[model samples]
Target chain A: MRITIDEDKCCGAGQCVLAAPEVFDQRDEDGVVVLLDAEPPAEQHAAVTEAAQICPAAAIALA
Target chain B: MTEAPAAPAPALTTRRAPGCPFDPPPVTQELREQAPVTRVSLWNGSTAWLVTRHEEQVALLRDPRISADSRHSGYPTVSASFEATRAHNRTFITMDEPEHNAQRRRFTGDFTIKRMQALRPRIERIITDLLDAMEQAGPPADLVTDFALPLPSLVICELLGVPYEDHDFFQRCSAVMIDTRSAPEAALAASQELLDYLEKLVEFKAEQPGDDLLSRLAEQYLLTGESTVDECAKQARLLLIAGHETTANMIALGTCALLQHPDQLAAVRDGSPQRVAGAVEELLRYLTITHMGRRRVAVADIEVGGQLIRAGEAVICANDLANRDPEVFADPDRLDVDRAARAHLAFGSGPHQCLGQNLARIELQLAYPALLRRFPGLRLDRPLEELPFRTDMAVYGLHELPLSW
Candidate 1:
């Protein structure tokens, strides 16, 4: 899966990090989205997709 | 084309439907179907666009041009008192952009899902202790006072390092701030009093650091000059009030909803962790206690749902109605604990979506099963209709939920 995120759109609600921590993280300074792994392993694909779907700001997108 | 005589605009403050306490005010549901976003008159002599449909609510909330700053000219305040509170200190949620992000990020670590999971055992112990007290006191208790209010209050106190003994004081001030009935002067005074108290506490914490949030905030902000002492205090006050009031109401109201639906209550009682977690999301969606809507002002003209929200236009995202939008949730009115309800806007959406949600989730997850298991035969002490719901307050909840086992 190809993962994409717009940091400017992140509100730091932290749902992405919660859903797939190995692939997503928040900047400690301002809680904006930080991609930990742009192409995470297949095992993390479902969680990354779920995170993208539930992101309140629609900041995360995966293909 | 001649414009037919325009109908008089509806007042947004009208009471919720008589028999349907769980439903959004009937007018809002109707608006969702017809208008989706339409102007409504407020308690004050002002008009703001009330956005009702779930899709529109979500889209608009994520629009960065919409600002939540209460002090902005077109922002709709719940009442004169709510407007007055803005003159004092605006909490982080009411802020936008870089400032709000910076302030909110400061506390995100404390509420991350991972951090909250680590604190679950401690939260479970707190719930257990409260249940023990309720059990010892026996049946026929006002759950609002005996259990609901205190559980979150105590947890917030420990989290912020504020003494639990001072709950009565802060809670009273919080009520004044949120109570739509309070006079502007009274509300202003209550806010000032709480600010002064918090300022003092922040000062004390700075001098004598502890593991609590306030002390840590003090070391991080004050010591580094990232924020002023007053700023830290105001943030603490926001956390204390939001942390307890919303969750407390949820506990009482959720329990009441469960009792009304024995099958749903049984589902929660079964305690399969996944089932219970799903139940919490369903309960949050069904009982969106922040019924006044999240108010905002459009900073730039934006077309949403085929309507143009012009710059400087006030908007209220009616979440309660949005949660029940039939286009999103099937059989929306039914209380089904197993429903997939995580997408609901109970904690709101966008940058200002509830910051304490992770903490709130754990509290509710532990609260429901613990309360139910402790009092196996729990039921309402009086007829459900006779109980007074806090409709007059900015937040929707039971004023006092009486219970018996």
Candidate 2:
């Protein structure tokens, strides 16, 4: 699965990091969500889904 | 244009400290009953319209016209204030919508009732583990240092993927920010130091992402092939600062409120989970840890509590007063565990309700009962009057609650 972050909508709460650190990260300055891996290796796909699911902003999308 | 309607209050004459910052002026209860909303002077000698009435407070806190950003409304800061209070509050809590909504959106999931419920098991484990540790340590222990303080701080740190050991650094930074005597320079300096460290962590997370929020944020947004390093650090600073301090204050103050009322404490200890839940609700109501009001700047002419608030006037919605409003609550002063206290402004009401209310609630529900049951004999080591209290801090609390079980 591919992970995506809608920067405009992300609040940088850092919840994504807690759910799946391998995939999602919060920028320290702008406080917005950023995707670490556009497409996770097959083994890490579950982490991507977790990040996508736990996102408070609904800014993360996993395809 | 039509002329503005003036405030209902006549110009007031006297300005005084009603009591310790933690203790509200007994007259505040009357303010809600009689005047509701009246223009009054703050302890720092600044002008602010205090909203004491129930409906008035609800209307004002939810109103979009009231901006939280102090820079916009000309916040009435004191002659020489510390920088920490400003740094600590400058994030979502102090911003209006758009910026506030945008920033709050990022961290929103961590606070949902469902999300917090999911966290219940972990919270319970933390409480039980801490109780074990406290029991192992024996009597005359510092509850503030051992259980009350550590549990929430540790939980928030884990939530943010921050190393628990690094807690000392952020704890120091939070202290500086909350200090009544801290100079603006001192607060700013501490803030900068923490930001700088977080900046580096963001970079490391970007190049080699880990299974953490900082790592994810770094890889996705910070490393976005464009944003500056300093910018990411500022955001991290906001997260750590807001996450831990408020929860810490709540844990300390909430425990004290329960200890002071042992009959209610016994009810919490012996009752079912439902009773514990009710007790938790009551504690939030009685304690009202965030005793201060949310400051707002009026955008245009508006009438609140039968008073016409002119544009640009400052408004302070007293949450403490709202929690104790007689009309909404039957016998508001008495701590009834089953009083349907959910409507309280403790987490606040309306659009700006505390974003962390869910997490805060779970922490209390899990921790308080385990604490009382583990040490049924727990009592204050010193007289309540002798305990160290922080009256001047933004979030007032006991510096150290000495407990002997």
Candidate 3:
């Protein structure tokens, strides 16, 4: 699974981090999306997908 | 394209069915089924489109053409007081991007999921201390006063560097601020009083900085000319009111709901952290405290659910109705803690979603289990129907929850 985030669109509600903490994190300075792993392992696919689907801002896109 | 004049629309109301305090007003449910995107009259006799279905409501919330700014003409406000106070109380939530995004980002770092999670120990300590005090005072305590209200109030005060001792004063002002029934003058006065209080605090923080949000705002935004003292205080005022009021309602109302559902109560009390987290989501969905639909104005024409909403028309996204939509959750009205209910619109959806949601979640996850575990015999002291629910306020909750152990 591949992940990309739009920092411009990110409102930092942090649902992505809550859903897939290992794959995502927020910048401490502004809480914008910080991509921890662009290409996550297969085991983390479901959570990463859920994170994308539930992100309020639609900031996280998964491919 | 001439059309016949339409009949006057029914007025939107805050009335929940008698004895079913948890449910949205029956009219809203009817509208959801019959006309998901239909016009409704506001309190001012102005008409606004009411979007009730989950699917369409989410779409409208995400639509950039819709404006959250209350200052816009024909904006559907909750009450005259809300209309009267809008000019005095505008915050980031009321502004549109890219300004909204810029203003909101300044404080998002402090409320990120990770930062809130890191405060778990401190929050747990607050819960424990409050519970200890409640126990020492014995049974038949007003949980709202003794536990639910203070837990969030204390945490927010410490975080914002506001003195907890002033809770009584601030809480009183906030009460007036949210009460939809308050006269316009009273509402304006209350908000001005809060803004004045916080402005003084911002000035003090500038002089003697502390390791808190207010101090950070003073040093970073206030001094840098990025924001004025009034602007800083307005933001702080928003945090102060929102940080406590919404969460306090959830804590009290959620506890009341659990006491009535013994089996669900047991699950929350004996469940693991994951289980408790799930329960919190379900409870938030089941008892969405923000019963007033999210109000907005359509700046551009948009079609939703087969209806064309024209520009300059006001819209009310009835989130409570959306949260209870049967299409989203089977047996939509049931309080099933085990359900995968994380997609709920309790905090709303889109760019204007609640910022303190992560912090609220941490506080609730710790508060519920701690309270239940500490007092195994905890139960409501009075019947649910007899409790004074905050129906008059913009946010739905209990005025007081009488509890005994």
RMSD of each: 2.2, 9.4, 1.5
lDDT of 1 by residue, A14-59 (tens): 8887677899987755567889899899999988987887798788
Docking class of 2: incorrect
Residue B137, candidate 2: Cα error in Å is 1.5
State the weakest 10-residue window (summed lDDT) of model 3 chain B.
B1-10
Worst 10 residues of 1 chain B by lDDT: B1-10
Candidate 3 per-residue lDDT over residues B1-405, each given as its tens digit: 222129888889878888899998887788788777888888899998999988888888888999999999979988999989998888999999899999999989999887888888999889989998999989989988998899999999988999999999999999999999999999999999988999999999999999999999999998898899999999999999999999999999999999889999999999999999999999999998999988899999888887888899999998899889999989999999999898889999889999999999999999998999999999888877899998879889999998888
- Better candidate by lDDT, 1 or 2: 1
State residue B327's C-alpha deviation in candidate 3, in Å.
Answer: 1.5
What TM-score, to 2 decimal places, does chain A of model 3 have?
0.95
Top candidate, metric DockQ: 3
lDDT computed for candidate 3: 0.90
* Candidate 3's DockQ: 0.81
Q: DockQ for all models, in order?
A: 0.51, 0.07, 0.81
Q: Which segments of candidate 2 are over 4 A away from where they belong?
A: A1-63, B1-23, B76-89, B225-231
Q: Order the candidates by lDDT, highest first.
A: 3, 1, 2
TM-score winner among the candidates?
3
Q: Going through the candidates in order, state the TM-score of chain A alone for each one.
A: 0.95, 0.83, 0.95
